[model samples]
Target: MTKDQLLEMVRDSTQVMTLRQKLALVAMLSMPAMIAQLSSVVMQIIDASMLGHLGTHEAAAVGLVSTTCWLFGGVISGLATGFYVQVAHKIGANDAKRARSIVRQGISCGLAFSACITLVGLLIAPHLPVWLGAEEAIRGNATLYFSIVALAMPLLMMNSLAAGSLRCSGNVKTPSALGVMMCVLDVLFNFLFIFVLDMGVLGAALGTWAAYFITMVLMMYFLVAHDRNLRFSLDKVQKFKPHWDTLSNVLKIGTPISLERGVMSGAQVAISGIIAPMGSVAIAANTFGVNVESLCYMPGYGVAEAATTLVGQSMGAKRQELMRSFAWISVMLGMAIMALMGVVMWVFAPEMMAIVTSDADVIRLGTEVLRIEAWAEPGFAAAIVTYSVFVGAGRTMGSSVLNLASIWGVRLTLALLLAPTMGLHGVWIAMAIELTFRGIAFLLRLKFRLKIRE
Candidate 1:
């Protein structure tokens, strides 16, 4: 067999693309996504570095409520997924008008949902730090940070909808470019709000809020006015409100994914509660450790975004071979990049931690956890990209269930058992083991699904 056929990760792709062409196609789609995701990680790393200079207490304060913030953020993303998946499918089917129609409906529904989130966040902000068991000294920062997040919810929701719509329409460059712009805005704002104003953690939060709000407006403008697939004609009647059928289709695809993210994010909140009592050093370490790992996992997330869009479009076009080929290619590429990153993380763990913080104890502990976690990075990448493939193919529920079970059943249970004895090490070990299991399971599932086609 020729080398191209031998490297074929999926049998169906035999007639779809040669090895060189597939690699080029994956790069065309994945590069923009990679850039966007990397920008996000850089934003986080910068935030962490800025906060770290304020000492362990300031860093710990943000860490205490980070998971809670993620919980809400995860749900919001889920909501966006509902509408955008349909857009992807429509675009794949070469129905640009329908895709544009979905964008309009998405904006309306997303804005309404965001309004509700804002109200909910306002009600919950004052009390959330206490609920998460944060120390009294740190609670004020947590409260202020969440309040800003609440106020920015509308803008964030708009950005998510607009960006996802663009991605689905095969225009990753605008969103990627916008993401870099947002990161730059965030850094500048944080410098003024945090360093110049000396606002500490609250300043960090405000900067983040301003960045998203501005980026949202810019991105939304692009989607509404400039996008090829999403720019609707002005004369269309009932332009904003989508039909019930269209709305349902979005919900049908997005609900399972939302539910999955909701539960997983909630679990993260619970895990954070467990971590809160471990002292400021531990909390800082946990936070910094997460950031450090971002260097390794960011590529996986980037590749996953590409897989989702490519697979979603392929499915919409009813090109099963193309979808399978894209899926395997993305997954393999993600695994390879992440594996290399993981090795770098292992060797430079201390340096990575040092970049984020100067506290010797915090850096030392964070480095250890990162090294322990690095072993699982490739598997983690596998699960990340594969799930996106599943989502694109309208098979999100099963992957969601597997992820949920792995996090809650395997990770949390082990963490609870190990934390008392092993402290932060225990918690991270549980995470590592769960990620490895999750990755293997996802790959097996992908193999089985392809086997059915054979």
Candidate 2:
């Protein structure tokens, strides 16, 4: 095939693609993202292992402040979605000029929002460890880690916008490559700062921040200088002012997503609080369980990224049938891929846990939770990708409502009711059931709600 033929194969819309062609496109879009997601997970596992070696308290210290990372990251994801989704639609509709305009406006809005996040995060860092109910022994280290990481919010948000915009333009490989590079950089910096320099938890935080800083620079360079469809131009630099209309649409789609993520992350902090009182071993295992379970679900997230781009662009092009078709295909692909990862988790839970921690209790408890969570992966896939579909169509409210409801109403309530008797196992079972419920709920909406609208 010629270079142009390959581009056509990779970039053609679902309106012209057969089912097999669509699946091939899905793999092309998703596989790089999947590897990127896995690379991110591997970096976190490496961090956990190094922290675990430092002592249970060190691991617990990082864990105490970890959910805050999710909370912040969730908001950044929502913010980037607003602008990038618009770009995806424009690309689909062949309005490359408008798409580029939206990209410019998006960077402005993202940076503005990052400023707000930075101010709030810094002000609260000292009190965050206390608020999370972390034990006194690890509170200082936790505070330091939180502060340093919080300072990097702007770099992280910038990277999110740059990378997301590039992906939405159908150039996934560049961002994926940079993501893997960042992960590797994170470990190298972590090794030097954490062990050779003996900075402990603070070193870990600095290392991650440095990686974000460097990656953000390169990502922006690629978006501005090299992207095939949406490269930025200094002459085309729109005034650094709010595009009120664009901002309004972004808010309409992003607010619920932001709210959904905020609630989910907040609920996690609460659950961590519950785990905190159970002692360091419980805390260590809970933290370790979370990082381990994430590996199995990363593929689902990878495909979800593809769903958002494909569906958003299709909707932009006014091809409702194509949009719906891409949505279903993405959902099924995510489900199939994650289901296999789930099986792997069930079989190798102990080995995975061992790589993160040597504590027998930590390994055993983490393994049990992974097994409980394994059965829920298919359902988890549905929720992840379907929600991406909703975001692509700028129909985020319903899915966000469902996610907030399930995570809070089902997961939190059950964890509370069962934790006293069943402990960490109870928490995992609650998570598993809630995921299944969420998946079923998303599919119902996709079939009945989206179908009727169509």
Candidate 3:
């Protein structure tokens, strides 16, 4: 069926959808989102490959600060989620006016929030590499690269808000298309700055900054001026005023998510610290391994995005059975796809590592760790999609607690104990074990704990 027809099915609360119909709808929504996610990863891969040729240190510098960057990005996701999930609920309840108001307030509030984070990032940029235990030689590049990306934080926040708004509105195709466009722009800009201007790590950051800026503008324009439901000029709503109820709901839903992402990303930063003291080769290998793994797990995130939209709308419509069905379908589909991807990654681990970096030591180490990670994909998929289900139902607190418990209680503790003895391999082994455990926990929670209604 066409996307328009599929959207109709989503909105048709009375329609008793067949199994084929449900699967088709999920596939339609997921394919575009999956492509968009992969494109974002490809942009990273391109940056790493370009920097890899410049020498191991340039790649290592970015690697050193990557997790810290994710920490900020996670906050952006938290802010956007609060707004877009509300938009989805409003639309599902057939309240187009309310959705538009939420969109406007969300943009304003999200910008203000991102500005605070940008300030914090800027203040810490210079000191971050040192804190992460980077080699003295690479610290300067790491600081410069992070500072450049920090300056674009507002753009990143807006991009996320716009994309989330679109996805919740069932306009996944637009965001996915823009994502591909952003990747193409990244290639052009990276070549201009990195090759033509002879900039190294600094060039990579600038290239990414320029791409995000341009796409954020286009994304916001489409969301605000073009989208049928959320178009700003469609109604006489207060554009910037924050309604107490809406704002309160946003905070209630977003706070736990922000905290979850914050701590989870902090754990990643901590892991980076653990790997940092192992020297540049180990750092680069860990970095490359993460990039390759993204290739396998990003599709799971794509399915998760679909789950959030489906579940949020289902919840809004008070369709408990439909919500449960969508949740199960999304998680099962994600697991199957990622399980297959795990095999692909395991078989081609060496080739993938070679594409990212030329250094034999880095490639060998990254390949070994990546194969270890392959075994964790299905479990990782389970965790990723199930969490999105929780977020969609506005039941984030329990999942967030479980996530924090798993990451800290299990992953970091094991990594700390194992890293000194077995090196980077030990750290990855710890990660695989933790992911498998976390997945099973989430699956049980989905079956027993998640309430269909409040």
Candidate topping TM-score: 3
Best by lDDT: 3
| Full ranking by TM-score | 3, 2, 1
Q: What is the lDDT of every predicted structure here?
A: 0.84, 0.87, 0.91
Off-target runs (Cα >4 Å) in candidate 3 are: none
Kindly list the per-residue Cα lDDT of model 2 for residues 1-454, writing each as its tens digit: 3322433533455426677767777788899999999999999999999999888999999998898878988887788888888888788777777878888888888888988998888899889988878889999999898888778878988898888889888888899999999999999999999999999998999999999999999999999888878876634555656688888988988888887898899999899887888889999998998898889888888999888888877777777777788899999999999999999999999999999999999999899889999999999999999999898888988899899999999999999999999998898899999999999999999987653143
Candidate 1 structure quality by residue, lDDT tens digits, 47-115: 999999988888888888788777777778877888888888887776778788888888888889888
List runs of model 1 lying over 4 Å from the truth. Answer: 1-16, 234-238, 450-454
* Predicted candidate 3 versus true structure: per-residue lDDT over 182-206, tens digit per residue: 9989988998999999998888999
Give per-residue lDDT, candidate 2, residue 14. Answer: 44
Error of 2 at 165 (Å): 0.6
Q: After superposition on all CA atoms, what RMSD does each candidate show versus the true structure?
A: 4.0, 2.0, 1.0
